[model samples]
Target chain A: MSGASVLYDVPGPKAKVRNRIYSVLGALAVLALIGFIVLRLSANGDFDPARWDIFNYAGVRNSIRDGVLATLQVFAIAAVLSLAVGVLLAVARLSDHRPVRWLATGFIELFRSIPLLITIYAIWVLLLNNRTELGLSDNQPQFWALVIGLTVYNGSVQAEVLRAGILSVPKGQREAAYALGMRKTQVMTTVLIPQAVRAMLPTIISQLVVTLKDTSLGYIITYEELLYSTRLLAGNTTVGGENPYVQVIIVTGAIYIAMCLALSALANWIERRGRRAKTGIGVVEAGDVGNAGALTAAVAAEAAADTTADTAN
Target chain B: MNVLLDYLPEFRAGFLGTLAITAASAVIALVLGVLIAGFRVSPIPPLRAFGTAWVTLLRNTPLTLLFLIAFFVVPKILFQGASPFVLGMLALGLYTSSFVCEAIRSGISTVPVGQAEAARSIGLSFTQTLRLIVLPQATRTVLPPLSSIFIALTKNSAVAGAFSVTELFGYAKLLSDKGYAIAVIFLWVALAYLLITFAISGVFRLLERRMGVAR
Candidate 1:
């Protein structure tokens, strides 16, 4: 049979046999590794039915459910706020004023470079230290700390995504908007940003998926997120006489995977819809922008042609 | 400031520990990523399926969950006497390898099909073509993204602190517990991370400038 690879021709008789031997050896090697892992795990009783029994308990299930809810709550707040921050920063970075652009750039770079775990931890500590002065109520500080940390980090990432999207728009669109006598803000808000957002929606949503996963960092600050609750459940003997560490981890990890995959699937769906809509300026027919003089000359020639066509009509 | 000055030695040790963990895990992740990338592009259906499944599962799951599993389950089931440091490295390495695999696979795709076709027409096997002709070109395209992934790996080493692996953040936690100002301790920790990450980015930028091919 012919191979699917465009790079390679169909294997001849002896080559086919050699390829078959290689494939079998590779498959056997992978299988042997898996078998070794399973055997070792079973020897240590990791697969014992009793070890998994705790997950069947009502209390354990409820705790896990509550953990999932808490995780979602943090994620929801962070996701919305981060998008808002991202837009603000991206706009600021693109500002006409030099100072505004520099400040926004600095903020994004600083947060992006630092470890997210440290950011959340620091915010949690600060909030805890200032709890009385700030008049924060009833463990709200942990929630805010997680949300804020996530907002800062992911917001910076989203800003870059949005900026790239905006930059990718054909320069003619911007010139057209300007020719319509629109202000910079008006052009940005009404024309450029909307199209940019549509173009980059897939990236924005995937970043949200990342934001969802990063919520687990709250566990370090002792926030009762899903990972923290799993740790608690695994360590507590009341759930079961034995530590159901493996079982709890499996269940919690599966929940995370399900959520992230759902987000990604949604992103794909939206991307397909956006492609179908195709609602923007068509691809630039002109060649590369080249130098400023060339671009201005092209625009001038197009403007003259437009005027002549208008007069003839 | 006094607290920082007094704990400078501890902070130094922690910084070194963070670097060590990041370096070790990065090496492991790179090797694993190459193998996984090969699997992903292999002719065998099972290998491709396994590679896809591994990347999807690992990439979607929270790194924290992986760390917890490493700390709690792995030692009990796999390596009975391993240190938290080793477990932390294992978790970080495994989690980051998925991202690295993606970077590598995408890099591989960027290498023109014609190059591979030429190699194959010259009687090179798939492995030989990939190793000799494809990967070297792919590396040029892959370096920028690969560097970012490693930068991410470095920042993620902070998670090890939670598992009691006395990296930078762990040391900050210790100082905070010892009556140092919590805000100051963490600010310093964050600054240290910023320095390291910036250095990594700067080095990568230099490497890219020197080695990158103009498209």
Candidate 2:
């Protein structure tokens, strides 16, 4: 068969044999690696039926369920809170007031440059130090710490994403809104933000996925989140003279992956819808703005474009 | 605060630890990423499937979960287990490698079909075409994103602290437990991280400008 690929030519007889050999070898290598892991774990009694039986317990199932609920709780609170913080920071950074702009920039830069694990740890520590003064219960500190830490770091990131979206809008639209005698705030609310939010919906939702994944960080501060719960259960229970860590970790990891994948699927759907919608401005594939590094590149690119436009004018 | 000043040597060690983790993990991420990108683009269906599975599963799972697996689970399977330092490196490198793989694949796609066709017409094999005609150009596009990934990696190295790796975050954690002023400890810790992050972005930015590819 003739090949249509630009990368490779249609295989001749020898090439066909070689390709088949490569396919078999590659599959074997992959399967062998996986098989080795399973065999090793099996030798270690990790896959023992007794070890797996932990999940069959009602209390164990409830813990897993509670873990899911807690993870979702943190995600829900962080998602809404981060979005709100994001909008505030984005608008403030773009403000005409120099002080506000600088402050916003400083806040975003500080939290972003620091690793979020550190931020969350710091907040958790602070809460512990001030638990009595704040009138908080013992458990409240970790929950608030994780929430606030995620809010600050993710909010800064979302601000940059939102700013990029707003900047992607053509100057003519903003000017048109202004020419209609709308105030700056009115023009922003009516003309810019709605379009920016729509254009950036996918990026925004993807950030929420990051938030969801980051909730596992709550495990660090001993928050009774999903990861924390699963870990606690694993550490507390033992079968066949070994903790069910392998079974527990794998199961919980699957739960986290499923939740994130569902959210990512949602992001893809929104992006597809945005593309097909009658909007002239194509959002294109800004899909991976999920990471700080990617978002930084985007905001920097946006800044670069604005400067070039200014230079051209 | 004198907390940072007093523990200058310890802080320096911690800083070096963070750098060590970042550098080692970065090497892993880059190498694994390139190989996986090759897999994704390869003609072998199994290779492509493996590549897809690697990225999807690794990228979606939390890095914290990865640390748990790296520490508790991988040990049982791999047997004898390495030090936490090595485990932390593996976890961080493996996690970041997924992002790196996606970046490289996207970079490869931007190399344009015409270039590959031209290479094929000139009798270049797929590997040679990718190496000679495609990847050289793709590097320009790939650098900016890779910079950010590295910067992100620098920040992420802090996570190693939680797992007993004693990087900057762990050092800060240690100090906090010692009853130092939290603000003082964090201020120093923050500065150390900012230094690393700025150095990464600056180097990448300079390289990007030298290459003259802002995007």
Candidate 3:
């Protein structure tokens, strides 16, 4: 059987009849649930065009556009800063010195365990309280607070991601680098990290997508990001005759989904490109010459087993 | 320290509230996740498509947006009299279920195909095969990732505080508003979270040691 068929079997005649009955019942159940939800929502005027028409207003459009821009700005700054911090922490965790490694591990664990919202709230309050002493300008503290909280939390996560990637690299590569008289940092930057990055690129990019979505947490602190602005827009009666809370939320949620999907698409493209590049550790054919036939035989045996399994199904 | 003692009742309430929310949402998420995973691996094409769509849609949206929808829209449409606690629970549960489904699906994939094939050959129904032969094996492999999801659920419960749910962060905010030090209050809150999460990690680690399959 193909991989897809492994989890189930092709039904016999009797079983097919039973499965058909099950299929119909299941589909009807799902449809009934959908219909009930739709009827209820319609009863509440949630589907009314007037509520959704707020999107057409110029002021509402501008506010949404500004919110999108602000959200993107925060995401971009946080993404870059977090990646930088992640690298620093990963290096620190991998340091030969015990204290450095412990310190890095402690920081990552502490922030990782804390909720991103609390971090942002704490930072926002801290900055507001110390704004005069710190010489921070108005309106910038919120932005900084969001960015810093994201940086610290996501940086800790990315550090673990990078550390895992680095660890997955073969120890032989690092030994080879040292054998060539390279220093520890040089070995890391040149040999291990480069390969580690290629291996973990998909994970890194996915975490970045996560970071993008997480920018919404700024709403809790009234940072005027996409979700926060949606709330404000929903409350503004001038935009639409109704509250438009449902409509604004749906639109904002769709925008977030669009952004995250785009990031995921990019991650997929890069993953495919990386696969095609095949920049993994090259095998040393010279040393493995004698075992080549054995290796090929092992592969042949595995293929035969797969074919047998397929035929059995 | 004196300030923390003064607000001991608030702190206790907040801690318990956070725990209750996390437990409720975690249970909801686990149930939804298992069903979604079943749909994902089902033979029926429509079921697979529906499962995929649900996971993709829910996963892409932020938890905060989910909460907004739950708070502002869902109650109006579905549960008119539900409290913010219920709304928060629904949002977090729905949002986290996607990740849980993904984890469970991956675990299901790790179960060797031959095992399922064997069960099917012995006249087991698809659901029977999953329950009897597949899920037990998948559960063992899934424990680690499942624990991580719950840990995340614990932290994400903090967002409910934003909706005035009186969770730990909410209590912290209340104290800060009443002339307490912001940094100190936050520090205590963070420490509380750390304690809970670390305890969770310890439990999972012990479970892993006891039940994990040696590769």
Candidate 4:
């Protein structure tokens, strides 16, 4: 993509001189903001050496490790569960049966409309109150609340994403499969879903990243996850006669940023690998799955492009 | 359901509080999103770098972590006596703004290159080209994604409830703690949120049609 740089003219002699001034001033302004924050934080003991020493403690280190592990455990289960839920819902939404399609639609939209915190808390309470009646393990409410909540919300989102991917597959592929005497289920499973999964891998992975980030919400329900662990450490500790919230924040925040960036980098790498693997289909730059109108247009554009490709072949 | 009827005032307050947070944060996210989008596409390298850093960091960090920082760290390090509502707005707005910036940036990319080149050829400055040509077209086409982001902002405003803002989602705990049934509380709260989200979706649909944005 040539991008939006063409909005400006090429720099001449006077423009070059002005550009230098703007660049210098811009750099200085950014640095100044950074400097101001640093100064303010230091003045508040955030940068005190003692505040930074908490990580050296074995207990603190262990707490963080456990927190990260718990967070990942929840994320792993939720990610898998959500993807499973997504596929089922997407298929049901696409089902030929009217009632089945409407039920899936209703379920997806209902969960999507409600915030996840409410869902998790509601599920937690319901599970707690009905533990005996539902025959559920008592201690598992927090874990299940978080897992089900993430599963439902992310699953709904992924359903839309997968549906978009499915619809974007050229109509000829499904038609060809049907002409070969394939059953509807066979056509969907062997033809549509695989290609849909492949085409929408980037979007699917990014949504997974969202799930990973959202695992932090476990702190809200006292799940003792990463954020909760660090929060306890931050709240209970004292350094140089003051709480080192800023220091804890900086460290905890960095871990999150690092984890997320690593995931994103992996996604980019996989996408690049996919492009190099002689894939006939191109990955559409997917945006919000909730944009049904835009999604329709994008998928249509993709199908048209693939149709033209088929003609050329 | 009777709990909601009995506590109609509390329920109404919670719903209105949620709306207030969403509305306030929506404004902040939009303004910051636009400014950062400009910075991302600007000629100045450092400004562009700053914009990229802002989006990357904010987008990666979870909204809960942001709210934690806003509530805990900011009060101690930056300023004291900052209300939870203000801090929640800043946190939610800052987090959502990254998504907003990305959407707008992609929208910028979708504007036909010929439009920009044509405006540049007419001796228009960068800002002039953006104002007169690029942004108008970009914003028009960008509504669908923008609406999605704002709807996300509305849902995310629920995170504020956990941060002690006593919004709609926070009412979940309140009504439940009062011995009301969880299912009933969820039904009413879910309905309230459905009202907000559907209203948001409906408004955007109206706006999209009014703008005659292309399908």
Q: What is the DockQ of each candidate?
A: 0.42, 0.54, 0.44, 0.53
Docking quality category of candidate 4 according to DockQ thresholds: medium
lDDT of 3 at A288: 11
Clashing residue pairs in candidate 4, if any? Answer: none
lDDT of 2 by residue, B25-95 (tens): 99999999988988888777789899999999998888899999999988887746599999999999999
**Model 2, A1-313: lDDT tens per residue?**
0222557777789888998999999999999999999999999888789999988899999999999999899989999999999999999999999999999999988987778888999999999999999988968999999999999988988887778778767789999999999998998889888877887777777778778988989999999999899999998997967789999999998899999899989988988887788854655353454222222235646533222111110
Residue B150, candidate 3: Cα error in Å is 0.4
User: Could you give candidate 1's per-residue lDDT for residues B1-215 as a string of tens digits?
Assistant: 78779888999999999999999998989999998998888776668778988898988888888898888778766788898899999999998888778777867877888898899889888788878998889888677666777788888898898788979988988888777778788778878887787788798789889887677
Candidate 1 Cα outliers beyond 4 Å, as residue runs? A1-4, A238-240, A276-313
Show where candidate 2 strays beyond 4 Å.
A1-4, A12-14, A290-313, B213-215
Error of 4 at A176 (Å): 1.6
- Per residue, candidate 3 scores C-alpha lDDT tens digits across B87-187 of 99999999888877877887887788889889988888888998899988988877766777788888889989989887998998888778788878888
State the C-alpha lDDT per candidate: 0.78, 0.83, 0.79, 0.81
Which candidate achieves the best lDDT against the true structure?
2
- Show pairs that collide, candidate 2: none
Error of 3 at B92 (Å): 1.0
Candidate 3 wrongly placed segments (more than 4 Å): A1-4, A238-241, A281-313, B213-215
